[model samples]
Target: MVNELYRKQLYFPFSHESRLEMLVEKERKRLLKQRIIMHIDMDYFYAQVEERDNPKLKDRPVIVGADPKKGMGRGVVSTCNYLARERGVKSGMPISRAYRLCPEPECVYLRPRIDYYTRESEILMQIIVEETKAMVERPKFEQVSIDELYIDVSSLRSYKRAKELAKLIKRKIKEKRKLTCSIGIGPNKLIAKIASDYQKPDGLTVVKPNDVDRFLVPLDVDALYGVGPKTKMRLNALGIKTVGDLRRFSLDFLKQNFGKFGEDLYLMAKGIDLREVVEGFEIKSIGKQHTFEYDTRDLVEIRKVLLAEAKAIDKELNDFGLAYRTVTITVRFEDFETHTKSKTFALPQTGWSTLLEVGWDLFKEFYYASKKRIRLVGLRASRLVELSQLKVLKNETRRF
Candidate 1:
């Protein structure tokens, strides 16, 4: 009996389930030691809002943007539901083409309701801030155009805490907004942002720091943030397709070819991003532009478009709580040649009326050449400082 007991203890001390449980416990503890970041992305945000308001639009292919005009309209798609995307439609694609793809398409081509969306965004942001103990950060430095957000959940180190917070945020957003959001959890902001996109339309993905390599290795190099079309073509020409292929090249080699952006690409491909989530971010500049399907030299049309563009910029500045000290006008000729002319003001200003007056004045002075057909018009505001930080400039300082 003593010999049999000794053999049992030596050969099968733990059951299979018990061993698996031990492995899971070890992994969970290991993950808890690292900084946990989360990225929350609303699924088809604009379309979802439209759907929520109108129940008849549910489960249907909803396209939000400019009117297709039966495959002859100008402008680009802003957002589309999953059902529309499955039919070979995507954001930024020509609205005309979107109409061509969808069978009996339910297209809603209307101007974006800036005020309504702003209110919704504020409500969702408030919910995130109030519920979670995590440090919330936004991509407002570039533009408040991101439909997604980066949150630092490092305070919630334990897996249990992180999971609970994620669940709560998701539930609250859905309950309050009647919309779905996908969330990604990772060790840093970059990984979390990428992970959130891995699964879409209501996905929740978590990637431990140690597991980042396993997941990122197979993704395309272009999948990394900031790798635009030009960069993607360049990387593809060099036989660098996947993130794994990019990893083969040294950081020095990448920098030599692509300059500073190349170095950033190399680090990002290796899943190494250390960007911090900053709070109370502000915009540096505000601008608006439109591409015309047909080039024309009509001054009346040009002035109309410029006024509308100025109003859009004004709206954006107001949303960001910023004021501009300079106004710029850009014109593109039919041949795709572009030139910009700008004027600086002594006082900070952002009202739509003021911006339009400045824009019209600049256009009249700089746009005397009637020989060339105009293809595009743009308005820009710069030299921005937050309204709260404004300081009056003295008369001597305003001479410039």
Candidate 2:
């Protein structure tokens, strides 16, 4: 019996039942490996909101940003409707320049109504979250930004399911908020994000894993996220002007030059992003501010106020059961000049004194930079992580 147990079985007789079970397992594995992701971006979100609420702005070019002051505004364009964009106006272009490109009557420049936009965003997100939940349990959703989101719908499967969901989402947004959105579907988030931007306002594009290479190879390397002008120039110098070129570049050469970032870029070129669609988005920073009855230049008084604000943050952070890794000091001068300085730690700290120490260091650095009297000073703690969640992860890690 011992000898028989020690001897390994070289072969087993095949049967119909065994063959069927093996096929079933293979199919299950294939299904389990499937990934379907969608990226949805609201078109000219702020500008669209302006036109949606007021039909009068529909046929006109609407530029949303700072007050153009007829031709001499301080800030830049937040966003512009497609009509404005056609005339060469763009988001982040200086308001003065946008005014130059397309003067008043040619375009209607308006300041950003952030509250209105936020309300609309909230309504849209709530609708999407709830609607997706009805289709899939704990449906993977991530709010990429104020006007962009990514959803994982692999559980639903099929291009048909993705298309139906996209149509439903667009319809829902139009019905609820009278707004339009563009959506893209792909095997992963990278392709989805890129495809979402492929067509203009209110377009849907789908790219499967098999088609990813064909789609990306033709695009410029600059189309890759995080590839700025400098990086593009460097890539151009390396004769890697296109996505395919970057992908086909020598791996060792890239590593010797770019280090870890080279590996990341290589993976990106291969359309392989392993990041999951995370659920909840945490508030990055918590802050407290005060406006004094009078503007005082007293550093002692400023430090005292800073300490008080830090202490308040301590109480709040403690109550919230959170810790922070960044300390930022906000200073606004009587002249309306505002600046903020911050320091980020390698690890999060919860102690009140730690907050005060970092806060003071930041304030002192900025305070001496310009000897102008500080009208108002504030303290903010950011890069927060929940203690309860941290503890849970730690315990789970140990158990594993």
Model 1, global lDDT:
0.74
lDDT of 1 by residue, 192-275 (tens): 888888988788888887688888899988789898887899999999998999988765578789988876776677676656
Clashes (backbone N, CA, C under 3 Å), per candidate, total: 0, 0
Number of backbone clashes in candidate 2: 0
Cα RMSD (Å) per model? 12.7, 10.1
| Candidate 1 TM-score to native | 0.75
Worst 10 residues of 2 by lDDT: 1-10
Best by lDDT: 2
Location of the lowest summed lDDT over 10 successive residues in candidate 1: 135-144
Q: Which whole-number lDDT from 0 to 100 does residue 298 have in model 1?
A: 77
Cα lDDT listed for each candidate? 0.74, 0.79
Q: In candidate 1, which residue ranges exceed 4 Å CA deviation?
A: 1-34, 103-111, 134-146, 291-294, 311-321, 325-373, 388-400
- Evaluated at residue 124, the lDDT of candidate 1 is 83
Model 2 stretches astray by more than 4 angstroms: 1-33, 283-322, 327-342, 346-382, 387-400
